[model samples]
Target chain A: MTAMSSAGHSRERHALLLMLSVLAVLAILHIQQGARPIPATVMLDAVLSPDRDAFDHFVILSLRLPRASACIVGGAAFGAAGFLLQVAMRNRLAEPHVLGLNAGASLAVVLVTTYQPVVLPDILMPFAASLGAAGLFGLVLALSALGSGRFDPVRMVFFGIALSALASALVSAILILNEDTLEQLRFWLVGDAAGGGAAAVWSILPAVALGLVAGCLLMPQLATFSLGESISVALGASVHRTRIAALVVTALLCGSAVSLVGPIGFVGLMAPALWPRLHQRPSLGAFLLVAGSGAAILLAADILALGLLAPTELPTGALTGLAGAPVFIWLVARRLT
Target chain B: MTSRSADPPTRSRLTAEALSVGHGGQAVVQDIELDIFEGCMTALLGPNGSGKSTLLAGFARLLPALGGSVRLDGSDLATFPTRHVARVLGLLPQQPPVPEGLSVFDLVARGRFPHQGFFSQWSRQDEAAVGEALALAALADLADRPVETLSGGQRQRAWIAMVLAQETPLLLLDEPTTFLDAAHQVAILDLLRDLVRRHRRTVVCVLHDLNMALQYADRLVFLKEGRIRHVLTHPSQCDGRIIEEVFEMPVVSLKHPQSGLPVFLPCASRQPEARP
Candidate 1:
């Protein structure tokens, strides 16, 4: 028995090591590949010494640093949020984007840029987005509880889809009303870190930190809840309370990510969907694995977006959708078979 | 929240008075008054849609009582906080979905949630409870295996282990043998009996198999159409008339030669013309 337990422990340790190494490799690759990119050696030296040459400094500190940091922070938030949503709802398809949170945040941002431009300098756009996302989440929760006292997964997904379409329509209306600001909003709406400075990254740090802490605390409860509401209750968990807490955390994280990266699609859906294949449970280790995987995917996509067609600069959100769609399709097909 | 420390832990009792339970303001079970004492394994037997589960839910305080009250330790259930109630009572619903990729050990460890606080997440007591539960359920061998990958019987045992880990005085189970094979069903019933005998835990389980209930339970509460038809104390008291009345099926009760318990057999249908 001791030997068997030791073997299982070793396997878990090996998996953890592998995930950490992969994350490290992705981080290094992210720093080495970009427009006017520096070599790996120069990037490392610039990271170690901030007072390097202006060109190396620009490549390392100004350009690559913020973008990579955004990927790490934004991706971790999206992945953790996605996992929480799926576990809380007990539905594999229930990602923050699919549940209309990203759409809600995007629409709110578009509205701010169109009609409330004067308020932009005074208040951050992400805060507005968070409010919008929370509102939409509340609507979904109410709709889900319409017929059944318990939260119904199918009804919630359907309501989210409908709300997403409505949000999209509102965004389109705003863009049409303010045609002059359409070009400026268009670039931000497409999900890219092209001009996001350290300020934008810092804006979401508190939300991300709080969300991660809450998500970790709720992990054990969510694991029990995934068994079903009755079992959760029997095991001394308050299913409704746990789900609400999870939803609030998900909204905060996804809203913050969308605020920073402009509604990056598929990261939320893809991360949790992929993590279980590598790790056993959605424990803290699995959470970290999914977060790291999400960061790696986004960072890699950013690199590909920049390097694929040099000087053309395809938006990272477009690349994620383009890349995520086929991969998602493949996953579905695999499941079907 | 009343202080449970002031009261004696042993001899705890649960009773429901005119309890009506339902969802969305629609009552499914009405006027249920029953007493469940400590150290007794009570089986709630009824057909599907007979509100056996609803009654058990009411007793466990999972469903809100529409008109009456469930009293634990002679106090109204509502008087206790959720955590206090949880520490005293544990329940296992029917065929609950297992979280994918959750190991059996972690799944059972969740039973300690009521006993834990934010700072005292994983304590020695919790570990010991989990270990004892796994051993009691005969799942120590599969502790590291994901619950999703286990067989139906093993999964059911693992779930029971989770409830056992709660260390509650009262354990309520809804159809604990639903998906098991015949042998597995008997094994689970035996295990439940052992738990009641060895641990002195008060158990109320919803059962479909009348014979198993008769053999395993110290008390039998039969329900029909949400009303308590009869409560029998001994297997010999559960004869053909009670079974026929509650289940709406004609059956013959005979003594089991091996265990000397009451065993039931469904005879041929009685025609209207042969009513004599």
Candidate 2:
């Protein structure tokens, strides 16, 4: 028994080391591989001791540094969020956006900024998104209770899909009615981290921190819940508590990214899919690995986005989608079969 | 929240008075009274859809009673907080889902959740409890094997091992030997009988085999059409007619040559001499 536990411990440690190294390399590459093509030595100088007058220093410090961190922070949170959502819902294919949280947040923001009288700053958008996600989640909860008082997995996912479709249609209608800010809205819709960079990353930091802390705390409980509701209840665990914790952590992670960059899709799905491949069994360590690899995946995607289309930077979401689509499709296929 | 600590525990050890159970606000069973004995094994037997599982669910407080209430040690079972009930009684479902890629030892260890806090470390006592449960279930050798890789009977025993690790005084099991072959069925029933005889733990299980229940359980409650038909205190006290009425199938009782326990056989006639 001691031998097996130690082996499991070593496996987790190996995953941790691997993900940290991968994140480090990708972060440096993310800063260096931009359109400006700063050399490795200059990138090191920009990171270590920035000379204020150097154009390279100004470019590295001002542009790529924040952009890289935002991707890492956002990706890590989403990775952890997706795994938690899957555990809560008891569905292997469940994703962070599977519950239509991003759709609710987007639609709420669009409606508030376009129709309402409140002139809010971009940073305050996450609060609106939080409200929207919470409201929609409540609606889902209430609707699921219509037939049975218990929360049914199929019913929850069904309502989420239907509501997401409805929200998307409403958003499209509002977008058509107000084409005046079409250019700005188009850029926001595609999801990029270039414009706000460092400021946006700092805003998202608390959400990421909240998600990481909460995810770590709630992870063990979530594993116990997969045994089914009766066993979980018999074990003295309140299934409702696990569900709420999952919702709160998911909301923090999803709201942080959607409000900042509109929505970065598929990092959550891919990170979880990739984590178990690195570790033999699912544990807290595997969860941490997923979060770390999520950051790595995003940073790598963002670097490609910046360098792929030279002067005109591509949207980070599009690049992740391009890489994530085949992988997501493959994962879904594996699960279905 | 837990009950007021000042109040003493209930008097009737796990009693249900005027119990009615329902799913989705629809009552399935109504007006049932039962007293579960401590330090004994009780078996619930009924035909398919006779509400055997439903009654167990009510006793476990998994379903709300349409009327009446369940009490443990004089305290209302529903009134006690979830963890408080769990500390005393543990229920193992018919086919509990084994987590993906988890080993038997780890799965059994998960049963110790009630005794643990979110911040509590895995203590030596927890280890001892898990080790003992695995040993009891005859699964100590397969402790390292992933649960999904185990055979149906072994997996069922593994689940029982997990519930044993919970270390609850009262255990309610829903069909512990459903899918096993006849040999394994006897093996599990023997194991459970050993539990009652040696450990003196209170066990309430829903079983399909009449002879098995007659041989193993100390008492049997027969239910038909969502109500208890009769309670048999001993195997010899059971009437063949009552079994026929509950199951809608004629049966005959035969004496086991060695143990002299009643063994039930399904046939057209209830006469003992209808053939072998």
TM-score of chain B of each: 0.92, 0.91
Tens digits of per-residue lDDT for model 1, A1-337 = 3443345447666666886787688778877776565778787777887775578777688878888898888888888887788777776667687678989888877777678756674226656787778788788778888866756766877898899889988888888888886877777688886647677898788878888898888876676666677766766677779888988888888888888887887887787666454322445666676777777778878888888898788888998889777765676566569
Model-by-model DockQ, in order? 0.41, 0.48
State each model's CA lDDT, in order. 0.79, 0.79
List ranges where model 1 is wrong by over 4 Å: A1-16, A117-124, A141-155, A277-280, A330-337, B1-12, B270-276
Model 2 agreement with the true structure over A1-337: per-residue lDDT tens digits:
5665566678779879988998999898888875577889998888899899999999998887888888888788777877777777776656656567767777786788677658876566677776676667667767876767766766776887788778879888988888864544676667676746788778767766877888888776676776888988888888888888787777777777776666677787788777663222335787798889888888888888888877778898898888877876786678679
User: How does residue B146 of candidate 1 score in lDDT?
Assistant: 84
Please give the lDDT score at residue B96 for candidate 1.
77
Extract clashing residue pairs from model 1.
none
Q: Please, what are the lDDT tens digits per residue for candidate 2 over residues B150-256? A: 99999999999999999888889999999899999988887787776678678999998888888777778998888988987665688778888999887888887
